[model samples]
Target chain A: MTGWVAVAGLGPGDAALITPEVTAALADATDVVGYIPYVARVAPRPGLRLHASDNRVEIDRARHALALAAAGGRVVVVSSGDPGVFAMASALFEALEGVPAPHDLDIRILPGITAMLAAAARAGAPLGHDFCAINLSDNLKPWVLIETRLRAAVRADFAMAFYNPRSASRPEGFARVLDLLRADCGPDRLITFARAVTTPEERIITLPLSEARPDMADMRTVVLVGNSATRRVGRWVYTPRSA
Target chain B: MTGWVAVAGLGPGDAALITPEVTAALADATDVVGYIPYVARVAPRPGLRLHASDNRVEIDRARHALALAAAGGRVVVVSSGDPGVFAMASALFEALEGVPAPHDLDIRILPGITAMLAAAARAGAPLGHDFCAINLSDNLKPWVLIETRLRAAVRADFAMAFYNPRSASRPEGFARVLDLLRADCGPDRLITFARAVTTPEERIITLPLSEARPDMADMRTVVLVGNSATRRVGRWVYTPRSA
Candidate 1:
């Protein structure tokens, strides 16, 4: 069999949001690899082998997928939301950099509905205007860089979407982010916290920056801070196209 | 029939990239309205009426969709990518702001795989780091704001995806943008021009900022400028997870 590896995004949480392209990739795969939760989203079959690992082992998972594919197995590496956005696609490429032998393997990155866009759609179009997406976790980068990007985004008057805002290991980062936003964006700037978006436990809260607390977000949540012009239109919150 | 309006994204010219949620919405739609090219993507059924209009009439299209839905016709406003991202969702809300009667109408924005992400996936993960999306068309906003955002994005070391980079009416804007990028990002920074992405006519070209020309991008293209750390791995271009 001609082997290949497809880094597929499953979208946010809803199965309906999964694209037919990703679905086809899964169907054609003989082995699937990803974080435990994401791998569980795939169905079990007679010939397919599922290799699920814990979080923070992304590089190892990518290496494993490459090995399987190099051995002539069709491998699908799954990620929640778009694989290109803070997900598995980059990690897979990073793995490729560490080893030269697998450079010739067939690899494809399939895009999906990322968390920010899904949250933006659910809450109306707060990101309708120009926007910036920042990952708040300081695990890969320093806190100073995050602050700089946040400040620069505010200066540009671009709406902001924050990923990996809060986690049990790093609870203080999101609070500092909130503090910075309240100080820079002032009290009335709109902020949205969408938890487990598109899932059964989905909860969306939109309030002013002054009213936002760090506890409003968790690892499963994606936060959105609007530009200076974003506001509520009746029950919906949107940034004007002109702004 | 219970009428509603669903602003749907058709997912960058590929039928398989469209989500089941949008497909279900279109199947239930009695009338579909959008720009001529986007509306033409939807198949016509006996009961379904397709309303294709020329471009630059987003507000009028929004108003028409609202009128249809308010008159108890299920309507879907189609956009090429996610409706909330420089597309029809915000325009729909802007139309809602003009008239109060349609405030009670049922409306939903269905997310799709946007062109940038599709292009990024096709060229590997050049948007893996913190990124900003800007619409280079100065139709709604002034040219000064675009320049400000571009400078700020570069200062913050964020990769950028530019939409509507160049059009027939405004051919000189992209040349200016290329000049600005080369000045700020230096000659060695990588830039990718992906035109008609995910389509049969798709073409992707990657070069240094010094080598990018104004003619490389058109209205059908989405341009990606890498962060300082973005580079080529084998034949693929990707931004590393850690900058």
Candidate 2:
């Protein structure tokens, strides 16, 4: 039998948040490959061999896992949050496209709780309506593309969920995005900042885009920008029902 | 000790999708209360008493769960998706507001994977930008309010995720919502129909708003309307990014 690979989302650093399908996939896998932090999340299951690696070597790790699968082993590749959302699943597919492998392997992506969804739920439905998720890293894609997408989402009146909005190297990128959003989406749009969602140190703050301070956000933060229809009722922020 | 009640989201029919905090809460709970369908999803554990009820008696079930918690039992009220998204969590809070209980019970909401998120993931990145979730039932709120919200979401250029879009008793509601969206969002907006998300029979279809027929959707279907900025790249649909 030809080997198969399943890319499973473990969810935001929680074992219980792993889906039943993901659990079954892990249980049936003879080998597992993932980033070190994500690999440690899975407790030792019988007959499960783990290949842990640093975060930087994604293509190499995916290639190794696919090779194991092509060798007739049931291998599972794990990622935190949803595998398709800036996780290893896309990289796996991208890598597979480039290589001419000997055997045909089935690639399946099992969805899990993304950080944006978790953060939105934690912050009381900031994402109750339309929204967008943008990565500000500008590492793989050009900054111009990010800027274009951001402007388009704002003009389209979408609630915005920003991932990797800011880092030590890209500190000004988030602020720049916010500035553009404020210009196009108006400064009064509600913005919810969620940090370390689902963890003990989780912090959530609901504010307006006009009042959002750059100091409050970081690489760990997931910033949610409310749509034009979003409203502030007392201390809670929500996107009102569409009419 | 004054008993505490925690409302938890179990995610969409998958046990592993339950968060770690929710799992810990359930593990520590003396009693678990939910509809039979939701209650059956979790594994049986020692010292955990279960109180399952029929589907229609949600408010009564929530009241009972709160009463049990008031009687000094560590209780957990469970909902299958996110607790706050048209689920029993709001009812629990509403019931609590009327109780006039002397003891202060800590009510914590642990987030889970809502069905909209699951459906969106299965259907590609249709929700990569702004969107809304509307319920077509109008069983509690007036249809006027639902219509108003729909228009507002569309005017705001939100991609929309509709819930309870159709039922045996209210079959025309989804069509009405589609009409309103088409009127405000125009005919070319992309619409993704997702059914039985994350299940064995999951089906996803992507089309334009003008092409989405009422016959294609039902109560189980989550209708995603792409925003004005949405574009189709071959088979994938996504909202263009704004900065």
Candidate 3:
């Protein structure tokens, strides 16, 4: 058995977005591991073993995947969005530091369409120019750092796209970020709120930042705050390069 | 017959990446219009009228597409990557302003993969945090505004991706922008030069801002400059949010 490990991005929710290369990698794997929801998106094939768990077990799941590959099993670890973007790719590497004796295990990462890209696509070209993506969740980091980054992005006049903006436990974090942004970027900035993009429940609304209320967003929504260059022409929203 | 238009994004290059919904829309269209290269990418179908032109005639082509749709025909205007990002969607709307029509024309934009996302995926996730995209092309816009935006992005410590960095006529512009970035971002910043991402002749290299030579990139290359938080770990590059 070949000791090999591959990290695959499942793209947004739609299975059609899965590339042929990703499909081939999964088909050749003897073991598959990921968050429970992501693993269900792939088609089940013969001679495949799956290990699913809740979201908090990232390190544990990575260790299990590494051990399986070290034991001479072909394994593939899955991440919902692009693996390298705040996803399983880093966790897998961090976990590898603790393991010893396996110097020849082949490891590779395959990319996929991230939620930001999918959301940007659905809401016109708010990302056409310079932009930023921030995660409002302060579970691992302090609120101070998040606030600093938000201020910097706003000062730079970058169209901003946010990920993990709000969660059930800390819903007020997004509101605070908005208040700070409103102060720096002003009220007329173009804003786009997208939820469950590329899925059946996909919802997208384009409005001005002044008109955006805190209740308009949730954990699943990705909020895009346009720079001063962004403008609305009829039903569409875009940020054109200044002449 | 009802007049309608669909603006479709033809993902990076491979036909497989085209969403099923986009394919259905294209199949049902009576006329297709785009720049010559983009129109050639789609497979040939019977009874479909093709309207192709060079890059300089975008306004004329857009006006022609609108006229076709207004004559009670289903029209699809194609663009490489996402239609709304520096493509035909906005131009189409700009051309529609003066047309006198009795019926409401339905215009829909279907999103596809953007070049920055493809480049970010090819390189590691240098875009994991706050970032910006700046166009180095001065053909349509003044260079003064571009410089202003670049300086702001650098001072803000936002990772930046530059589009149309060089051309045959203006090979020195990219180097000039790099010099300005060096002043604000410092010489130690990490930069990635991605050429033809997700294509057959793809090339990706990571280097430091001080050592970045203009000869290393061309018009086809998309330059990604990492913020202060970005780091290089062996073959991978990443930006970690402050904890």
Candidate 4:
């Protein structure tokens, strides 16, 4: 039998949000590998191996999956959201760069519903216009570049969604981000904080930039800053289709 | 029966990419409304009334869905990708601004896999880092604004995805866009053209900005311009995680 490797996205927290494509991949997999929580999401069955690693070991996980594939194992590497977006697919390819696999090895990347899109949906389309998605964490990139991108996105009048806004280790980063947004977008601009979205613990709130506190966001929060044209209609906020 | 309105995303083009959440919404729907192609993706059943309309009539279609829901009919308004991203969810909220519906009516936005993420997954994660999504069409917004956003995105050094890159009526727009990109992004920058992604007709190609032409894209194309750090590994193109 031929062996293969497929990297799939599991979508946001809701099982209902998972696509049939991803489900099928999991069903056919002989091994599932990912971060601890993500790997735990998959149901364990007989004759299946689950390899859950710690965070920041993405490259190691990718190498392991590749090695499994080389040994004639059907492997599925999973991520919470689309593996391509700040997730595992790129790390997989980065690992592939250093290794030489057979030309016929089957490798596929499956798409999933990303967190930014899921958060925007719950907030009634604050991202209806052109938008930018930025990961606020400085672990992978420099803080200077994050600031530069934020200013540029603001100058373009694009709505923005921010991932990893506030983590326990980097609580001050989100505070700096709020200050930058206030300086550029002004106090009256609207921003939404969607925490644990699509889950039972989900909580969503929209407030003016001046009223936004950095404490409202955590590791699980996805923050959205609207464009100059975004506004509220009754209980919802949305940017008009036209700028 | 109680009435509800769900603006669901069908993913890029594949049935497997559609979420079980969205599929469940359709199964419970009495009326499905959307553009002709998107509406056709849903299966026809005995109790379902499919209302497919022409393109550029999003407002009218949204109004019809609202009316159907107001009359106690379960309605599903579908869009190709996530409804929150340049799709029907905002249009429904826009229509809601002009009407007085009962506060008890059920309205939900179910997210889906969007084109950019799907395209990014297929092309190896050119959007793995910070990125912006812009619609190149000038149908609703001014061309000047589009140019301004393009310049802003380029200056920010953010990866970019362009929707509706070229059309039969506006052949020169994408050409002008290519010229602006070449001038700002430099000739060696990498760009990926992903057409009909996730579908059997899918085709992806990557090239330098200097070698890219307006004719390489069409209405079905989603063009991705990589960040300054984007490069090729073997047969794939991807942006590195760090800056």
The candidate that achieves the highest DockQ relative to the unseen native structure: 1
Candidates sorted on DockQ, descending: 1, 4, 3, 2
Model 3 chain A scores worst on lDDT over the 10 consecutive residues at A234-243
Query: Which candidate has the highest lDDT of all?
Result: 1
Candidates 3 and 4, the one with greater TM-score: 4
Per-residue alpha-carbon lDDT of candidate 4 for residues A146-229, written as tens digits (9 for 90 to 100): 998999999999999998898889899899999999998999999999998888999999999999999999988999999999
List the lowest-lDDT window of 10 residues for candidate 3 chain B: B234-243
- Candidate 3 Cα misplacement greater than 4 A, ranges: A72-74, A93-107, A241-243, B96-103, B241-243
Instruction: Report the lDDT tens digits of candidate 4 across residue range B99-189.
Output: 8743565789999999998998888889988899999999999999999999989988989999999999999999999999999889999
lDDT ranking of the models? 1, 4, 3, 2
Candidate 1 residue A198 C-alpha distance from true site, Å: 0.6
Give per-residue CA lDDT, model 3, range B1-243, as digits (tens).
887888888876766556665788889999989999889987788888888889867678878888898898789899886676667766765665566652376777776666666676666667656566777888777787677778767666677788789988998898898788777778888999988777788899998889998887887788888889787654666665432
- RMSD, one per candidate, in order: 0.9, 5.6, 3.1, 1.2
For candidate 1, the docking band is high
- Cα shift from native, residue A164, model 4 (Å): 0.6
Clashes of 2: 27
lDDT of 3: 0.76
